[model samples]
Target: MWRSLWRSIDRFSPQYFKYILNELRGIKVVERSNRELVIDILQSMVEIVTYGDKHDPIIFEYFMEYQVMAEFVRVLKISKNSRIEAPLLQYLSIMIQNIESDHAIYYCFSNGYINSIITHPFKFEGGDLASYYMSFLRAVSSKLNRDTLCLLVKVELVS
Candidate 1:
């Protein structure tokens, strides 16, 4: 059954995945008022990352090569609205949590990409959005080691 599922998944050619990813990348989340589209995009991203295994680097490589994280960061940078930022942040949080490779995780943390998501500098109105950020922080803190603890401390203090 698992092999059959894998075979079914394999039928999605690399070109097809690229086309879908390109379309997803093209979405302007900050400018669009369509809430459904935002959900769809984020959900699609979640599904992609979900399919990956902890030892599998293929999906992770594709994400890095395609610069999907950059797009999420771009949305956060250009938009002050939490409604827009929350989903993007959640997408990033999932990425942080599910990432299997130390190299990928290190790049995200060291380069300040994950920091930006954590310390968003934007105010959330109802405390709802703040909770989401807090959840992400907790997950990250739990996963921290001695080296990353220092960086996490600095980021938490600054945030």
Candidate 2:
């Protein structure tokens, strides 16, 4: 049943992604009103985007046009209390790891979005958070190559 549903993705629409992105953007991280909802939305967004990357580049591009990567970073920064950090990292890692296309990977790694999240001073005291953090790092590391190197490092003129 699950595989059938997963494979029957022709009905999936970009409007679904846009609606979820709107919900994600509206979520107030500090307020505990919709914590579980936020996590669920993150998982859905990642799943949709990952599947779209492999099945339909147009759907993935539509999601990216909304600046989802940068929004994820903003959510991570505001979610300093670790309420949703672990799951966010886990989903992010999963998403990044599943990106198969070089163009899609470049879109994710571009604009220093991933760099900001990686270098952010996240409170990694808990085992789960630390583990997911490392997982996220490993996922990002796997995507690194000569083309994506510029996204992570800056070359300043010293002269």
Candidate 3:
């Protein structure tokens, strides 16, 4: 469905891509009877966020929107016991890096989004899962371009 939508969109209009991406991102949060389908959709959305064309500001803006942030956080929160956890974390980390590379402001916004999501009241049950998330954040923070990191940190601290 999403592939067909993407193919149908006029590539010249970034807004069309943004609309499709937002809808796919929302699927990650929907309660579905078929868990496999949900996982597949989430995986596809992550891949789009990570590797889709960087020339589109609408794509980047869609990612920065709160709905996409919520879906990403929900995935990180709920996928702890699944076999896909490691790969999902890796994909998320790459997505974070891609967003950061494209816009420094988004780096700070996403970091805050992650921080808020993880620090919620419920206890996360899996030690390995928690460690993977922490490691991803640490890796991203360490490897971020120095100037971008400075800007991210400043915005994160202030906001």
Candidate maximizing TM-score: 2
Model 3, 1-159: lDDT tens digits are 778876754543546546555555555433335345555655665555554435555555565664566665666565433544555566666655555354633453545655654354433475566776676677567555655555445444554
The global C-alpha lDDT for each of the candidates, from Candidate 1 onward, is: 0.63, 0.83, 0.55
Of the candidates numbered 1 and 2, which has the greater TM-score value? 2
Which sequence of candidate numbers ranks them by lDDT, best first? 2, 1, 3
Candidate 3's TM-score: 0.53
Candidate 2 matches the true fold with a TM-score of: 0.87
Residue-wise lDDT of candidate 1 within 1-159, one digit each (tens)?
Answer: 778766544423344446657766676655556655665666666556545435445765676677766666776676535367667666666767876666666555665666667766867777577877877787677668876655545544554
The regions of model 3 sitting more than 4 angstroms off are 1-33, 76-87, 100-111, 117-131, 143-159
Rank the models by TM-score, top first: 2, 1, 3
Give the winner by lDDT: 2
Q: Name the lDDT of candidate 1.
A: 0.63
User: Which residue segments of model 1 deviate by more than 4 Å?
Assistant: 1-17, 53-56, 80-82, 147-159
- The all-Cα superposition gives candidate 3 an RMSD in Å to the true structure of 6.1
Determine which window of 10 residues in candidate 2 has minimal summed lDDT. 4-13
